[model samples]
Target: MSLKIAVCIKPVPDPDYYDQITIDPVRKTITRAGIPTIINPVDKNALEAALQIKEQVGGTVTVITMAPPNGEESLREMLAMGADEACLLTDRAFGGADTLATSYTLAQGLKKLGNFDLVFTGTESADGATSQVPSQLAEWLGMAHLWNVSEIKLKEDQAEDKVQELQAKMKIENGYIEYEVKLPAVLAVSRDLNTPRFTSIMGVMKAKKKPLTVFTVNDVDVDRTLIGLDGSPTKAGAVFTPSLSRKGERLTGDLDEVVEQLLQKLRAAGINLEIKSSSQGGR
Candidate 1:
């Protein structure tokens, strides 16, 4: 049976111009005025997973994202990655969304797409790195979800089954865990899952002809109170360019003396060190 997969992609601030990213303090959202965007790295992994499945079985891959209209370019790039269709959810009301609002809007966008057998998303976005949207989206759409998936395998159902169930390996702190999730599950994957294919010239040409749909807040059915700055529960406490300034100190002396100086500096900087002989040491 063929599958209908939807991969949620995020157009994050391109790493090249990360320095140009600014913040709108009043609204508590990163201001993306001058920065460019690229498909979030891990989201590409999600798309790659979808594409692999589409190739194995006769199926379709659809890419979805919530961003400003400029995100259309990134959506186009995703289409070139082999998605049959692309949808962009953009509107002024979607601004300043923390994971909650973002997931809600994305859920509405997915609902607008009709029925899907499976949904894929990066474990977290490159820019936000919140790692919350996938689970939240699952809650909104009422589907089971898993995170940090490193491998995915499917169990086929005979007689043209619409939904293909999956068995997956997930990364955990100590080791890993495996699960057999039922159909219509939401999965958030890590970059370790698969290598994304590059966009070819042929893909680019075909993408131009593929459908790239756009939706506004009013277009998708969503509660106004649950989908924007007003709906987001988490408030940005502070936003600033992370300072990478390092103070360089030169210790002019022999090895032992320099080591002693470094120790002194570390102590002064409030870093405690306990060296243990031939064993464990920390703090």
Candidate 2:
């Protein structure tokens, strides 16, 4: 029972040209034209986790992504990084999709690919950090899912070529909680999960020959009403640039007086400040 692993990935606008990114006033979406795209940073961590599992156990890793056709570039990069195969789900119908629609489409893609022992995704995409897709995708597929996973390990005493259980650490507010996850589940990994392996020259050249399949809305078993903008119930209310300018106040006073004024200003801004004497635990 060789494990079948699927890694969900996304192509996001290159961070290098972040300043060049703009919002379409009419569409209320990011204007991605003319900007380069790259694999979302944390998504590589998810891919790395999948690749590591495939290495430890007998398995095949398939990377999946839903984006415009240019997304093929991202898939090729994943192949170069050692994914056994890749799938690109692209179509005009997928435009303007919110988390729900996006996840729904991805669920359909997974369905078309057949069942897998595990599915991996980043906690969130860089462009849209809603962090909602993983859980929503799990819901659509009717599978158990976990997010913000910082670590993953195979449970001991597992049969060869088959993975039935996993030990994972989920990041919490102050600490992390661990779990023994049963297989056939989804995991949204965090950046700390693993460092992505670098692509070798040979791997890059070999990626060109690996299987890269493309699917459109017509290719998968999906309800037309449940996939793109029309399927997305939520829409952006507005898009605007926030002002980063801040006003500064000058304090004309001696050192101690200025410090007191500064503390008062901080308190006035709703910041709590506490000071204690040396005897009361003050340094």
Highest lDDT scorer = 2
**Candidate 1, pairs of clashing residues:** none
TM-score of each: 0.84, 0.86
Model 2 segments beyond 4 Å from truth? Answer: 23-34, 156-161, 248-283
CA error at residue 247 for candidate 1, angstroms: 4.3
lDDT of 2 at 205: 97
* Positional deviation of residue 95's Cα in model 1 after best superposition, in angstroms: 1.6
Global lDDT of each model? 0.89, 0.90
